[model samples]
Target: MKPFYEKTIHTKPIFQGRMISLQVDEVELPNGQTSTREVVKHPGAVAVMPFTTDGRMVVVRQFRKPLEKEIYEIPAGKLEKGEDPASCALRELEEETGFAAESLQLVTSFYTSPGFADELLYIFEATGLTQGKVHPDEDEFVEAQLISLEEGLELMAAEQIHDAKTVFALMYWQNKRLKAQLGK
Candidate 1:
């Protein structure tokens, strides 16, 4: 086995926005070759899989500008520069679903798109939920829906719930359901 790393020789900033920034980097490969890499820098984010007392999952349907369509997804938000992911998860849940959780647990964290973007996403599971007033960001428009496991699968099959985060939440939710059914 051998180690392969790209050393950045120069970086040119392309654009900076509230959520993300874009840059192009000149790099030296381990094989002594040079190339340019386009990198997207993000502030990371958090997602929450919220379950109601009745076992239905809480999802929000919103219009995504990039996709030019609406999609259903778990409650999620971008992280502040030094914010705690768990806190962000709870906040997003409440803002998006009008639910506050009494129990919140971290499930997993992963990069959304490692090849181009440096966006780390922390996924969480929230239970013991209490309904509250809906309060999404002024620029954000979403409608919360409670769906059964079968409905979730249907949505996934229909590509209504197309993001990786929501798919993962559904799969994890199913695993938990199975474990409980088997008394695990």
Candidate 2:
């Protein structure tokens, strides 16, 4: 009875990987037409926007194999099974940026690709960060740096700061600053 619901008739598992699994689902459309949907299942993830005491935003430059390029993104990582999003946010923030946040606040949770994927992502804002030691995963290579709001804008325009989550974090920061200045 949900709006435009597509009831699944059958699902065939395609491939299962460490982070994601693929499946093809046969569904009956609202209008009685049958079709197949290739879906990606994910264990979810967490992303953090950490701030330095000087107010610069902490970001990581890493190469993404799927993109075949290096991009600047805020600290992020996959959620371990049954992991709390906040804990995952802090873990990623520390592991990627070598910083621990005294304060962590959840900004929002969203589905990255609702059409073909069920990858839910939780975004967090971290303040009062203290530097520590970088300890990325055994196979992960990343370089962390800080950038000003203007620098973030420039990188975004250049596409160095790509990906939806990072772009959303930048926008959120900009909007928060604007609202504060406007006394809202």
Candidate 3:
């Protein structure tokens, strides 16, 4: 089967910014009509679900300028140019939460918003945690909170934690743990 949308023409790099770039493209639709799309290019990012030995999860409360409100989320950050996702995950976890993980396992990856942006997020499970000094960005205001896994789930159910990436990572962990217990 052939795809409905086919790229007929493309205008590359109308503008580029630190976080994203703009590309104008023309595509031929299934109905034999052409349309233009302004695609946003992103450098991808990483998010970490840090679990303490006792089964507590580390999260951060910070203000998101886009949301214009403070929200709780798992530690995450955008990848620097040419940086590995694992390195970015570890760095972001430590910088935001003052904890370092001895082992980080890649859980899954997903697009943040496939409809509009090409932002791919790599999710990781960080374990074997050790306390460290936080190295947050100068402009970043964050407070780290360690909550029980059960409490984290409750927060999600209560609508307190609304970040999509965080929810996805936590849910993935929950499902994995349940499967492990069932096998025991």
Pairs in clash, predicted candidate 3:
none
Candidate 2 ranges beyond 4 A from true positions: none
- Listed in order, each prediction's TM-score against the native is 0.98, 0.97, 0.90
Candidate 3 is scored at a TM of 0.90
Which stretches of candidate 3 lie above 4 Å from their native place? Answer: 12-15
Steric overlap count per candidate: 0, 0, 0
Give per-residue CA lDDT, model 1, range 1-184, as digits (tens): 8878899999999999988999999999999999999999999999999988888999999999999999999989999889999999988999888999999999899999999999999999899999999999999999999999999999999999999999998899899999999999
Overall lDDT per candidate, in order of appearance: 0.94, 0.94, 0.88
Q: After superposition, how far is residue 181 of candidate 1 from its true place, in Å?
A: 2.2
lDDT over C-alpha atoms for residue 25 of model 3: 77
Put down candidate 2 lDDT per residue, 47-155, tens digits, no spaces: 9999787879999999999999999999999999999999999999989989999999998999999999999999999999999999999999999999998899999
* Candidates in order: C-alpha RMSD to true structure: 0.8, 1.1, 1.9
Backbone clash total, candidate 2: 0
lDDT of 3 by residue, 70-174 (tens): 878999999999999999999999999999999999988999988768999999999999999998999899999998768888888887788899788677778
